[model samples]
Target: MNFYKNNEMVPMTRRYPDLKDKVKKRDNKISIQLIRAWDVERDAEKVLKIFLQNIDKLSSYRYWELLRSVWIICGTVENAQFFSSLMKSNKPNRHYFSTPEEHEFLRSLPDQMDVYRACNSPQDGGISWTLDYDYACKYAKDFQKNMVLNNKINKSEVFAYINRNNESEILIL
Candidate 1:
């Protein structure tokens, strides 16, 4: 029987002697074995950098899949922003972002839709929406501006709270 590690085929007896019995019992259709965790403390930033570096080499589906995984694993605002940027770049054909579940996810992200253009105007020209050009332009621009402003306000509030906490700590000391 043949065994594989990291997608490379290897001799079963030489590579994984312990799995020989299991492999035989499974009738050669055995797939996926759990290996020891090598990088239990893997850095999220390093992983994101590596993924972005190789983003262009991946297919659209693969890219979205990896991005979703990164977002889930890292669960950081920066990762969310990266995903929004990727979505904006592919705005004209953002079918993945248009699905009901994905649309809800996008809506949940703060300031993500701010950078997205979903209208047909000279300034926001790409794909045409079903609404009138003037209405669409106004709606898109107003929505984006409000979202950005809200994001900035929320960030300032967080910073102010942190600063206040630090000031109180210094006073206690």
Candidate 2:
């Protein structure tokens, strides 16, 4: 993880004497621009592997949330380019982003990122579903009913979905 220092960040362990060996105290700022003006530091998991490193502690259902959070953080064109630059140097690890088309589809629409986690649960749990494809389709159809129109979305063919406190809805184009 990286640390914020002197209005900039350096590798925590090597550069920040105060944060040495204090992994929990480290700030994982991937983008200085992304930091809010009120908050100079941000704990972006994408830039650092520490917070999500406790994979054993997470239930199987929460895996998708973790993956989605990572993708959302590091799946930008510049981030992809940076990762590619590392690759050219034969770096051991790399990250990738979706194509513009795929990314646009995602950001422009409402996303049910935790559908996988919601699979095979009761309605009271809010959006619980069977993992089977047929059941998933039915859930989608039912979920579609709760959406409201927004942007280019139409009620008939949804482009976005918003689940309001357990009740679901979809908006279509």
Candidate 3:
């Protein structure tokens, strides 16, 4: 689980475009083990096991990055807790924020925010939403049926605010 340190904060999307746009499906067993490993407190052994078992599929660095994306994409309370535990562990990939500024930015958001999303259906709601209306429009252009969705949400409801992508994404569980 090697995390490459960057001189500047680069969005995870830039580093791994597939994380957001075209995530490859994982084996159910691999997915389950990943959840189990992170779900437990400091279960380094489980994390290591998954890495070793899937070495042929991904490098350690990419594996951890994929996990980071999954954490954000899932936007579940359990996944959030798992990631928090992972950050506290002694693993080489414990680094969560690219910089202190990134951390501070997330902490400094207002108590309430207007968030938006672009999806295929009006009823479609997902964990990921942007704070920028223009960016939401950018996403809406992707599909003929895509519609822009917006809502005002309390800060407490935001599962994560990742400015690394410069998208002002707010993940709600």
Cα lDDT listed for each candidate: 0.32, 0.31, 0.57
Q: Number of the top candidate by lDDT?
A: 3
lDDT, candidate 2, 44-78, per-residue tens: 54233532454343322222233333433443333
| Over 4 Å off, model 2 | 1-40, 45-47, 77-173
Record all residue pairs in model 1 with backbone atoms less than 3 Å apart, i.e. clashing: none
Residue range 111-137, candidate 1, lDDT tens digits: 312222223333322221211233334
Candidate 1 lDDT (Cα, 0 to 1): 0.32
Per-prediction CA RMSD (Å): 20.2, 17.9, 12.9
Q: List the candidate numbers ranked by TM-score, top first.
A: 3, 1, 2
On TM-score, who's better, 1 or 3? 3
Deviation in angstroms for 42 in model 1? Answer: 3.3
Please state the error at residue 130 of candidate 3 in Å: 0.4
Report the candidate with higher lDDT, 1 versus 3: 3
Report the Cα lDDT for residue 117, model 1.
23
Give per-residue CA lDDT, model 3, range 41-71, as digits (tens). Answer: 4465566567557745643345555455444
